[model samples]
Target: MTVRFELYSTWGCHLCEQAEQMLQQAGLSGQYQVLDIVDHAHLFEQYRVLIPVLACRHTKATLGWPFDQAQLTAWLQLQLQED
Candidate 1:
């Protein structure tokens, strides 16, 4: 099964950059899209502290920030299995 991870991010977020690097190191960056929520006020406000959130494309299951390789892998696997 293919998993598409979407990360919500914005400019000036060092943590978001770090998360991107982590995903790349884990070889998962190519499978995801990093969306900048700065232009979307509601999204920006809602996700300011929640930047770097990961979400499944098909099911929309959300995983918040401060995640690592294992958590991301587990979340992706769970989402795929649910589908």
Candidate 2:
């Protein structure tokens, strides 16, 4: 299945873990995929310091860290509307 969102992250990152939990709590567990930046050279370069970035595949929109569930939901709504 094609995922609507991509979560850029890496291992051993507390914030990244929290972001995953947030996604789960927001009921987006299946609509997204977690991508390890370490496994992709360009992603590593772009998100090394910006781990836990949430990107919408459909609209190419991104939401960085420090986001709560409400913010995430709002972003998703915006992206869906854009699509």
Candidate 3:
């Protein structure tokens, strides 16, 4: 099963940058789509305070900022199970 992730974030956000680096370190960089909330009105509103969110498109699961490698891995596992 191929897992796809959507990273909701905006430019110049430190947390967003960290989240992206975590994804890269996890070897998930290619499987994710970076969606800049600033490009979409609804997305910006929905995730204004929740930037740096990692979302599973198939399961509709979301992980907010301040996550580490362990949390990201667990979140992915949970989302996979839900799918």
Candidate 4:
């Protein structure tokens, strides 16, 4: 089964942009969706200070920002195993 991911982010956030670029660089450009926190009140409240978070749609597992490609790969692997 294919596991999809959500990238929680907001516009004009440099770090968020970096996270997106990292995903693209990691060859995951088509594997995840970008969700703007500003459009969802609950998400906005929960991730207001945690934009750039990557979440597994199936497991609800999350990885916060400041993560590199290696960390992202490992996280995805772990999530796959859990699910």
Candidate 5:
């Protein structure tokens, strides 16, 4: 089964772009939705300061910014193991 995820981000953010690139490089593309926090007040409040957050929809688990490829991989592994 495919895992679901969401990426909380806003426009004009270089970090968000970089995070997206990392997601693609990590072979996680097309399995997630990209949500622009600016369009939703609640999401904005929740992730305003953490624009590049990657979250598991089912578990509500989050990975914030400043993550490298290894960390991203490890996080994904942990999420998979949890299932």
Candidate 6:
């Protein structure tokens, strides 16, 4: 099965948009899901400062903000190679 990666984000967040665009430009569209925190008060509250966070759905491994292409790719590769 393909691993599903998720990005925690919100509206009016420039960084969130940047992250989304980075993912897309990195050719990650349709491979991962983006969850807008604005619609979920609880999640938004928990991850407001940590917007643009990435998470592995199955393992729940979270990667906080300020990640780059290499970091994102390496993280996903590590997860995918795990048994």
TM-score of each: 0.79, 0.92, 0.89, 0.88, 0.91, 0.81
Give lDDT tens digits, candidate 1, residues 1-83: 24487788998889889888877876775788888998779878888888888777888889888888888777878987986
By TM-score, who's the top model here? Answer: 2
Tens-digit per-residue lDDT, 43-73, candidate 6: 7888988888988777778888898878877
Top lDDT model: 2
Backbone Cα, N, C clashes tallied per candidate: 0, 0, 0, 0, 0, 0
Q: RMSD for each model, in Å, please?
A: 2.4, 1.1, 1.7, 1.8, 1.5, 2.1
Ranked by TM-score from best down, the candidates are: 2, 5, 3, 4, 6, 1
Candidate 4 lDDT, 1-83, residue by residue in tens: 24388999999999999999987887776788999999999999999998899998888899998898899878878987986
Worst ten in a row by lDDT for model 2 = 22-31
TM-score of 2: 0.92
Model 3 clash pairs are none
lDDT by residue for model 3 (38-72), tens: 99999999999988999999988789987899999
List the lowest-lDDT window of 10 residues for candidate 3: 1-10
**lDDT, model 3, position 68:** 92
Clashing pairs in 4: none
The sequence of per-residue lDDT tens digits that candidate 2 reaches over residues 1-83 is: 45899999998999999999998888887889999999999999998998789999989989998898899889988998987
- Candidate 5 weakest lDDT stretch, 10 residues: 1-10
Q: Name model 5 segments beyond 4 Å from true.
A: 1-3
Error of 1 at 40 (Å): 2.3
